[model samples]
Target: MRTLFIAIASVLLAGMTIMSCEEKDDFVPTLLLDVQDAIQVSNRGGEFSIDVLSNLSWEANTTANWITLEESTGEKGKRALSFSVTENENDERSSTITVHSQEGTQAELTVVQESGLTLNIFVKEGAEGSGKSWEDPTNLSNALKLAITGSSIFIAEGHHTPMNIVSGGNSDDPRDRTFEVASNMTLIGGFPAQASSGATPDPDAYPTILSGELSDGNNSYHVVTISAPQSDEEQVVLRGLTISDGQADGSKSSATIQGRDFRREYGGGLIIGGSRVVLENCAVKNNTSDKYVAGVYVFDEAEVTILHSKLNNNASKSNGGGLWANNSTVFAYHSEFNENSGGTAPAVHAYPNAEIYLFNSEIRDNKGRSFGAAFYARADSKGALVNCLVTGNESTSSNGGGGVMMYDNCEMEIISTTITENTIKGPGGGVYRRKGENILSIYNSIISGNTQKEGTMNIDVYESDADPAKILASTSGEVVFDANGQIEEDAAFKAISMLGDDFTPIGDDNPALTYGMTPNHLKEIDYLFPESEKDWLDQDFHGHDRSGSTTMGATLPE
Candidate 1:
């Protein structure tokens, strides 16, 4: 009995030893996660994924879950994480995997998106007794070249001494001869980093101040030639510069290019080529071309955007004295076009093929010789004005538009805007729509106190033709207004009144502000204004509660 028991016990012990050895052979090492280093990302929007490496098993049950990956601290609060494998390699000895995560979204990886390569230009008084009393502008050329290689160029605050650099480079290199401003490259000048005491005051405060000068040879040779070598999609941006005095054709200037015409010379500020460009926070003033140009000129194939800028006191012989868009696409936001004088439309002149959009802007105090005193659109030109103020503009034409003139099947949409106090010498004082099919859309807008020195009504469409039938009432069309079913004829003003040259419209306890649907265009946009608080909708200038139950345009009276 004892011998049998010992033999059985020995057999049992041997079987147990073999079982332990098999378990040891099957054991898989688990990888440990370190807590310190981790990936970072931006918290702007969207979910991020993170991958963790593991060699234990291929089963989904063995894979790490979100809860296991998350780490929380008493002071730091809860952490969120999602996991995904970007790249993976499976092997018995080692497995590698790239993991992505939104874990520390607020904790972003260090990224520097340099707005652009900058050209810092410092212009100071020339050295005394050096005979260089006249500051040479050649340095600007060199700096411009260097800046062109990069993204953008900034011309520091300083008066540019008189010097002419005809853009045409060496005769051999035609491309070089043509001073080409490439895509995504900006040329900025006279932009104050911070408010300065003695620098040029804000044009809003003082409109008559002469802030910029150009002394190069007095001929019209393209001073600033804006072009986009790339396709139209990739646009170049130019802003914050004061450009003037550069001639298009003159003795000291380069040979006249095809677009160059002293009488028809384009932009005194910028000659826009076939490109989609943006100009922001700038001043296009004191620029001139004899024929059909103005402070800012847009050609047939160009698409331009101007925001938060000033086009003031510019002169042109023919078209737009302030801004001209000839068969182009243009958009202006939160801008001021004021005190400009020209032969045709003074503030803005658009040809038939042009499509223009104006929002939260002001066009006032402009003088024109021919027709449109404040704004002009002709030949199938389509324009939309939203939350804008158009007033105090004058026209010299026998049939003129103090506020706006549309001809040749032109279409216009005006919404929640104040078009008042405009004067025209001719028939259609406030607005003139000629033989062309003109469509006007006015909604939640104010049209009062407009003068047509000799025209029909405060807001007149057809001049000589007194046919009320011909008068195109402000309606929906190629022109459209967002009334949200609440359209008003007239709201009596209370105690508010217009004051000073500013003439900023004051809101009363009118139904327009209290009960109105904010224009649809203003509702959907990314507002990028420079403000500390981010309460208003993106790109909306009218300080209102955007997320409220009721929709409205621009201003929301408290």
Candidate 2:
């Protein structure tokens, strides 16, 4: 009986081993992907693959419809599975693709793609079709409405008035007519429609104009309004266009003042609020306003940059015939302000807490009835003028500062600049500093050829004592003279005419030619206040390099 039991046990053990071998042969497989998390793709959309390390029948599925696999179901064994995605035209997008095996094992692959590029719109003169191309162009007003963010509007040469503008109130009132600019859009003018490739467009030759003319006898409105807030990453550019013949009467309502019965009229040419605007190689001229800021008004935290532009022949009833900055920051580089007339500040007016930076610019032939024919820095404001020219400005009334005026608590710095040929009827033909802790620093500059009927020729610091020695002693920095600098002498400028193309001063004998001192004080100020270098001191008015040897005035003697 024991021998028979041992035989049965041996047979049972052999059968059990054979059954285990058979079970191992029929084992189910699992899915294993090389990359289970993320895969980056290009913006134009392309094919990509993932390694599938498994011996099983697997099926693939995508969470987003933009992703598609080459084969939905496949028998994989260490093979690369191909997949493709469509082009991402909008923002950045992501998708997930899952591979499932028969054994219930799953792996996911996340795909990411970047956004596409922006669109470009075209506009040509006398073209009456769609604005998609140069051959079929549209009007300026239509293009403005059709433009979205990340769009470029290229305008050809023509006189472009505000056509079919949306009225602010009444359609018959010219003050209600408004032309608006969208955020993150660029308007580039002065281009010939049929220009050859690699050829630079000359703004003088093309001459695109934005005129504010109405046929119905209504001529009282701001020509352009930039009220859109732009992202910090991108700037809204208005370039190579002439803005002219704008008239802003008091018919339109604005922000109410405390003492005034009605809101003040402002910005006959352009009005900017809560926006980031850049004006490059443009012209603003022949504009008039009843109250303030006939040329351009920047208010309510707007940041404006004017580069290689011109503001001329603008008139205002109150202040800032060229530009008025109220609670805003303005940067003027290689620009010109001329023949602007205002009641207070003819060229520029910076209000309380406003910051004004003038670099390599020219302010000339401006007339102010009260104060600061060139510039006015109000209480608590800050101003810097570097390598600038302030000449031929007149302050007719008894206020002060034919070149520049600084009120109580205002701080100003002038470096490598020339303030000459200015006339004031009362005080400070070159510069005026009001009482109460005002700071004025001058270095490597020329303050000559200035005249005042009542007070000083170069600088006047107002106080009860009004002593020249006390005033010079109380100044913040060294008010030293430049090389060959003359005080109250004739600048000896030749052919300083107001003709169309003869505005520049001539003659090699002019003291302003090579009288500038090196801008060492700018480096010192930069070290003391690192943030002050935003007002550039490395270039002249005509975009010429200002190296060790610099010229005093705005331009090289030519």
Candidate 3:
């Protein structure tokens, strides 16, 4: 009986060992998540939780810096992960939290957070409530009436027109409609719907347009008129707004400016008169006029500041298609004037008493019916173009200057500016001098790739042949310098930013990257007039910090 018991015990032990080996061979680690759906967070952001289940030791990791986890590692069974997400001020984004077990079992949880939009007075199209909150929103016209000194009116995506506009002062057309803003306030556009908690707002995506198509062909004379006093001190700001489709219908009053009979028919898209205004990330475009100064008219000692803005596709009958300044001042930074047509200066025109300071801007693809496709500075007009790009401008009429023209006694300065690829039918390919003492003081700049089909190549002096050698080495790097280069072809440029031409120089093949000095304390046109716009001299077109030795032509080499 004892022998039988021992044998049975031994057989039982052997069977137990076999069963243990089989279990070890067939074992598999288990890691499971309680939730498979992704976690969602609002733009306000807050704390959140996720459930996890595992049979072995597990660890959690996330690469996103915006996410903060309560614990990184855990062991066994069902557990809850506590985490928080910060508020997103920019675009909406997403990230993944990876959960890994000791036995190579893994799970993932995605976290998506929306972008933020701030507003003091919300304006949405077809809203029935007040302008206090997103839910109780109002229209742009209503919000404009309610905006105060410190108020920031946020307009949502829609087409907004003027309700009540008058020509004022018994002018020619009293029925002309326009959106008139005359307060020290700010108008910011680009907002998702009030009920959309998951969407982000991009100005290009959700366009908030202020159109002037009042009734098809009978459009307003001016789409928007900014008459806000002290708007030049940045007291009034228009950001991410599109002003378009203005067509001048009625006649304008006549006035004498700079001792000349200057017609006051101006500003089909925007009008800044006797006040200061700021346009940031705004588009003033697609306007038409039978008179001069079609796109934007700056007059009456007004100051208009343009930052990262665009004036394009405007047509005029006489002088300026994109911008016209008369006894006023315009300071443009990182702005663009493109595709304007049918004027003396298709892009910009400064009257004898006006001044325009352009920095890190682009003048491209403009077509002039007469002279000066890019810009025209009349007698006694003075300004500066610093680190700007001028290219692809054309002139169909037989006059001068496809890029720029300087009349007698004008004083304009160009520093580290690039002028190239302009086609002219008359004298001067890049710049023209119509006799007299026109001082085009060019310093550390380039005049290359210009085509004069009927006359001089680059810089025409007294409507004669250009002295390229003298213009290249005239004082170079100094205040009274004249620096010019003829590279024939600009193959070293990177991607094209405008007019199918790349303005950014790249590689050692381009000399513009190393031919520049430090940018600071630029020379002004005058002491009392055309005051220097030194607000962003130390910054480049991309708003990158530029110090020491840097590249030229409104941008750095790639």
Per-candidate Cα lDDT values, in order, are 0.51, 0.70, 0.70
**Stretches of model 2 off by over 4 angstroms after superposition:** 1-117, 164-172, 193-200, 255-264, 465-517, 526-558
- Model 2 scores a TM of 0.68
Q: Cα lDDT of model 1 overall?
A: 0.51
| Residue 315, candidate 2: alpha-carbon lDDT | 93
Number of backbone collisions per candidate, in order? 28, 0, 2
For candidate 3, give the lDDT.
0.70
Q: Write the per-residue lDDT of candidate 1 for residues 197-265, one digit (tens) a residue.
A: 334423333222112243322333334566543343345776555555432321233332223322225
Compose the digit string of candidate 2's lDDT tens values, residues 1-558.
223434544554455445546776665455556553675554567677766655567888987888888978877555668988887678778988888898898888788665555567787765666888776778887877666555788888887777654323455555555566744679988888674333345789999888776666555467777755444666689999888877777544753211111222788898887679999999999999877789988887778999999999999887779988888899888899999999899898998678888888889999988978898999788887877888899988887888889987787877666677788897888888886777777755556557876535477778755433222101111233344332323333232331113223345554444445444534544421236563465655565666675455444444
Best by TM-score: 2
Q: Clashes in model 3: which pairs?
A: 231-276, 232-276
Q: RMSD for each model, in Å, please?
A: 20.8, 18.7, 26.3
Query: How many backbone clashes can be found in candidate 1?
Result: 28
- Which residue ranges in model 3 land beyond 4 Å of their true spot? 1-120, 167-175, 195-201, 231-234, 254-264, 453-455, 463-501, 504-552
Whose TM-score is higher: candidate 1's or candidate 2's?
A: 2
Predicted candidate 3 versus true structure: per-residue lDDT over 13-69, tens digit per residue = 455445546766665565555454465565556787776666567999999999999
- Residue 47 local lDDT, model 3: 80
